[model samples]
Target: MEKREWKVCVTGGGSFIGSYLVNKLLQKGYIVHATLRSLKDAKTGILRGFPEAKEKLVLFEADLYSPHQFEAAIQGCDFVFHVATPLNHEPGSSQYKNTVEAALAGSKTIFMSCLRSGTVKRLIYTASVLSSSPLKEDGTAFKDFVDETCWTPLNDSLSYVYHDDHHKDYTYSKTLTEKEMLSYNNNENGCGGLEVVTIPCGLIGGDTIQSFASGSIAVCLSLITGNSETYKSLKFLESLLGKVPLVHIDDVCEAHIFCMENSSMKGRFLCASSYVSIAEIAGYYIQHYPEFNVKQEYVEGKKVDVKWGSTKLCEKGFVYKYDTKKILDDTIECARRIGYL
Candidate 1:
């Protein structure tokens, strides 16, 4: 069979990364089965707008809360990409507990469905960097660079201790879900004889193929689109002093494809390109787009020193296509086209 005829399923196809993944898959000539939380959502329009979507794309409605809904979606898929995870960043939101619960339950549902499908050869899971490393509380550098072996020191006790902090809650949930997934992968009886690979990514940023901004792009839009309150609150001067691991969205999608096609690739792959500060990003925008009234404030806070390395991925012979400058330019251009500017 030709490459275009291969079958694959992408859970959460409506997501920022998932949507882009779907587009790339279609371009490669694969018959894509994309899942959405609701067919009426705007993402349906975005997915339908892709070239040849009518011929190559099939849509399925699935929810994390309901695993049974995914059975039909993955029935005959050669590969499965589990890219759906609930994120609630708002502090003091009532949905915080529900978000954590749904994430854990949803992962369980999908993993079991993949095993039961009996057709899935490889399952690529999209995990976050928070699962492996914790942000520095004091804003100091990590004693050493973080690699796949470094697991965040989060547990039941820490969860309770940091209960008041929503960010920590998010971190703890991701850490827990990743641990469970790994444990399931190692289980001789639980995997149902399938291969699993996890990609733990950092802050993902780039020009999205979709019409609207999502994920980290949305945050960047707020910074550049006259959101002075967001700019003032970010404390870019102090926070930018610390190293932040970032990966382009396209790089992230390529990482997923690389893992899916390479049978030997397994375990956790850190998908970050470089560490940069907020000030550098701001400077790029100001220098390139002088017409926009960008905020230039420098507030010195505790210096943060955190580093996440992707040496393992590099050794696997996967090269990143976008650097910091390219990422900024592409992201800004996309934002402007989408009218976020």
Candidate 2:
């Protein structure tokens, strides 16, 4: 199909990844029905200013809780990029039960809307790599590597009892949401045509629209910012997954496009170009950005490497544009440019 003839719907169009995807789609000549919680957002302004956006892009107001609200956005679109996820981001905001309920319910509604949208041929979902690992039922680490086959165990033993409340919730959110989204493909009822492709990306950080300092970027820059709490979370994740799996936001956006354009792709594909330790990250900062006080303590020399970043996407011909150094460089540059540095 010609790119110009395709009407694509991108949920969470104002989000870190969604805005970039919106811009990429516009540049590629795809008519985008970009959905946000509100029409009058700062990100929407930037989106509207993109070249050809005036003619090719349309904005719609939608929220996860209301399934009907998504209908207008997905209405005649040939493809859907289901990126908007329910996340509090702030620490200690609510009870864990509420968080899980909201995540699963919102995710189900979005998937159901996509299935209900008869015109949608494919739905490219943004799954998180955090959804994997805690491999054993007894809360152990991954001995070999992580991949699409490795799902995070959520049955009370590990993930549910994780010490960090926020971490536990986020992991379960992605794991449960992914399982729910992919399960619809086997629907025996009248709703089974929507092809679902999940690109589970690790820590996403890179160029971002102004005023939108993403949580991923913040996590990546925790060492620089001296945010011990966020840095602790990263270390815990590293110990649990046994690797510093990460990828630039641009690569993530590119993967989304690649999954949508290529017809043969299916199931889940994990994305990450960098797998280094906190010491490795600190080393880079110490060399190039010595002016800032980079936390040297992260070089604890207790690193655990794992093979979580799957090469499945590359095997299917998708190439990455950024490495660990480049991912850090772009993330730092973008963060500085946006005054978040």
Q: What's the number of clashes in each of the models? A: 5, 0
lDDT score, candidate 1, position 140: 35
Q: For residue 91, what is the lDDT in candidate 2?
A: 41
The candidate that achieves the highest lDDT relative to the unseen native structure = 2
Pairs clashing within candidate 1: 4-29, 139-303, 139-304, 140-305, 141-305
lDDT of 1 by residue, 1-341 (tens): 45456699999999999999999999888889999989999999999999979999999999776657987888888889989887663345443355677678778878778888888877888988766653333323343566787676654443222124445556667777877777776786666568788898877778787777774775554547756544432333123213456678999999899888775556788888877666666666678877875677421223456565559888988999998877777777888888876
Model 1 shows how many backbone clashes? 5
Q: For every model shown, what is its TM-score relative to the native structure? A: 0.85, 0.92
Candidate 2 lDDT tens digits, 266-333: 68888888777778888888889998878677665576656554778999999998999899999899
- Superposed by TM-score, candidate 1 places the C-alpha of residue 333 at a distance from the truth, in angstroms, of 0.4
User: Any idea how many clashes model 2 has?
Assistant: 0
